[model samples]
Target: MIDILYFAWLRERIGHGRERLETTAPTVAALVEELRARDERHALAFADIAALRVAVDQELTDFDAPLKGAREVAFFPPMTGG
Candidate 1:
């Protein structure tokens, strides 16, 4: 099972803080596709990939990054340091 977390507008759109999913996806992109296919909420949440930032196991990564052995994935906007 993989733990998927949502932040900011993503959480608001999906109406979920997090979810634990059993998936057969090999990459983050694939996982995203699977999630997006689940429902309208997920589709809306992932509609703009450019507006999303992903973290795998708490480390920032690309959507094409491999998901092997990853326990957690988080989706959020780019963090602005001021």
Candidate 2:
């Protein structure tokens, strides 16, 4: 299982901050597709991939990144400078 975390508005939209998912997804993008297919909340949260930033094992990564042995994945809006 992998831990999937959602931050800020993503969390609000999904109605949960985190979840442990058991998936056979090969990449971040595939993982997202799996989640999106689960419910409307997930679909809406991932509606705009361009507006989202992803992290794998706490390190920033792209949606195409491989997820062979990743333990954690997080999604959130792109950071803005103060």
Candidate 3:
């Protein structure tokens, strides 16, 4: 199972914080397609990919990043360091 975490507006839109998922996705993009197909909430949360940032195993990564052996993936708005 893979752990998926949602932060900020993503968590609010999806109505949850995190979840354990059994998936066949090989990449983050594929996982997004699966989630986007789940419901309106997920679609809304992922609607603007450009407004989001992702991390795999706690390291920032692209949506095309390989998910092989991934234990956790997090989605959040871009962090601004001031």
TM-score: which is higher, 1 or 3? 3
Ranking by TM-score: 2, 3, 1
Q: Provide the TM-score for each candidate, comma-separated.
A: 0.96, 0.98, 0.97
lDDT of 1 by residue, 1-78 (tens): 999999999999999899999998999999999999999999989988888999999999999999999999999988
Give each prediction's root-mean-square deviation over alpha carbons.
0.7, 0.4, 0.6
- Residue-by-residue lDDT tens digits, candidate 2, 1-82: 9999999999999999999989999999999999999999999999999999999999999999999999999999999999
lDDT of 2 at 17: 100
The TM-score that candidate 1 achieves is 0.96
lDDT of 3 by residue, 1-82 (tens): 9999999999999999999999999999999999999999999999989999999999999999999999999999999999
User: Which pairs of residues collide in candidate 3?
Assistant: none
Error of 2 at 6 (Å): 0.2
By TM-score, the better pick of 2 and 3 is: 2
The 10-residue segment with the lowest total lDDT in model 2: 14-23
Consecutive 10-residue window with the lowest summed lDDT within model 3 = 44-53
Q: Superpose all Cα atoms of candidate 3 onto the true structure and report the RMSD in Å to 1 decimal.
A: 0.6
Whole-structure CA lDDT of model 3:
0.97
